[model samples]
Target: MSTEVKDGLRISVLSSGSTGNVTYIESPHERLLIDAGLSGKRIEKLMGDIDRSLTDVNALLVTHEHTDHRKAVGILARRYEQLDVYANQGTWDAMAPRIGKVDLAQKHLFAPDTVQTFGDIDVESFSVSHDAAEPQFYAIHYEGKTFVILTDTGYVSEHVEGVIKNADAYLLECNHDVEMLRMGDYSWPLKQRILGDKGHLSNEEGADVLMDVLGNRTKRIYLGHRSLHNNMQSLCHLTVASMMENQDFGVGHDFELLDTQPEQATPLVTL
Candidate 1:
């Protein structure tokens, strides 16, 4: 096998929840960000946690048009005059019209099923089922391996299952436990969305998603986008761990599970 030292990929999560969300991706040729759902101050703190600054980013990549995904979009773009933004037409249309202006000069349109690059990091975008316009997930490629990120969706659709199945790493949604979500104190309508096919994936559902994809090459799994009101981190970790244990493969021997902190930065996923 060839070494990937010349073009390694690193993913760092700043925050990931209703409270906020952001992720930093570092490659040899580019420094990029996935989302900016946090306030400027919070994102700054997160950058500090990673021992980097917002200035390190060459551009920002948006997943969808939701606020939790766009919490600091315009602010950061404006703050850093040279920072470019990449998104699908729907997402850009949904967000770009808001400020009645554009700051970043390089706003590229992302089409589904397209393969492109941000420096040495290869990126692929695919459609996802969510309430927002043209919601999507990302699959990043580098060094003969792929890392797929699937979150903020009601469920893992068959389409997504295909894209994520053979990934070496995944930042997947393990939002809540079915029982806790149903019996907890959320409004009826809100609860329905969380459970719907277009809603977030519960711990059990997330496990099912993983089961379909748990091959030998799955090196890292970080269960993300957990709900603070209805879910506990330990439950998600334990539930996924137990389910993986039942599988035929020696799940824990090579694969490691990390939970994204709703209030803090997760350790970088390196490959």
Candidate 2:
């Protein structure tokens, strides 16, 4: 409800959908961008909307090499003097050719399934089920507060569920409605890909995963990466909220159920 950004960990979803995806996070000593999917100019404007300076970003973390997630990886790295780009060896190998040329010094690598500290933030990466060179889900820790980013994955793994418990906040994917996708305008092969194990998570699947990981400390739950064609924002939110209600968890009381847009940034929330 408050527009001012307070003390703990602060975050905003700049945009989240099939078109493009980006998230901005700030710790006491560092400012990080989880993905640089949008254009550099667009990203700058979105950060300005939240009163954050994109030029002050210290690092850019790439989740996978998809166009919607890594489109601006090289652009932002080139534009910001202090920004360093980080990805795993496999992701780097798959994305290097697509993101254009980044300076050698600005390129960094971190192993998956390990916790690495950058400035004041500690980022722990885990493998997820997706069709990429190496996809990751991050749990970032700062001053006792945790912010987890879980999107672009087809399914949540047991190991991921174990590591992501008791997070202060999350930007989870509620990508589509299964019935809608099955009857949408996409071709047979495209529809199959979306429904496959390596594709995106549907609304029901996302709810199923949340039921396993929701905890008392989870205050903000953002339903992100919804399909513009196959899923409506109201439907996606209601689907998850209803499922949680059955488990005795009340939306807006136990935790806030937030919505993200493809064209604008969500409210900047501090946990």
Which candidate wins on lDDT? 2
Mind giving the per-residue lDDT tens digits that candidate 2 earns over 62-118?
999999899999988888878998999999999989988899999999779999898
Clashing pairs in 2: none
- Candidate 1, residues 1-271, lDDT tens digits: the string is 1113235788887787656668787777778888888777888888877677777688888888888888788888878776888888889888876533555475778787687787788889988877888788788888788878888888776767887787888888898988998899999999998888778888878888988976777888888889898789999889888887877545567787888886699866576
lDDT (Cα atoms) of all candidates against the true structure: 0.80, 0.88
Cα error of candidate 2 at position 48, Å: 0.8
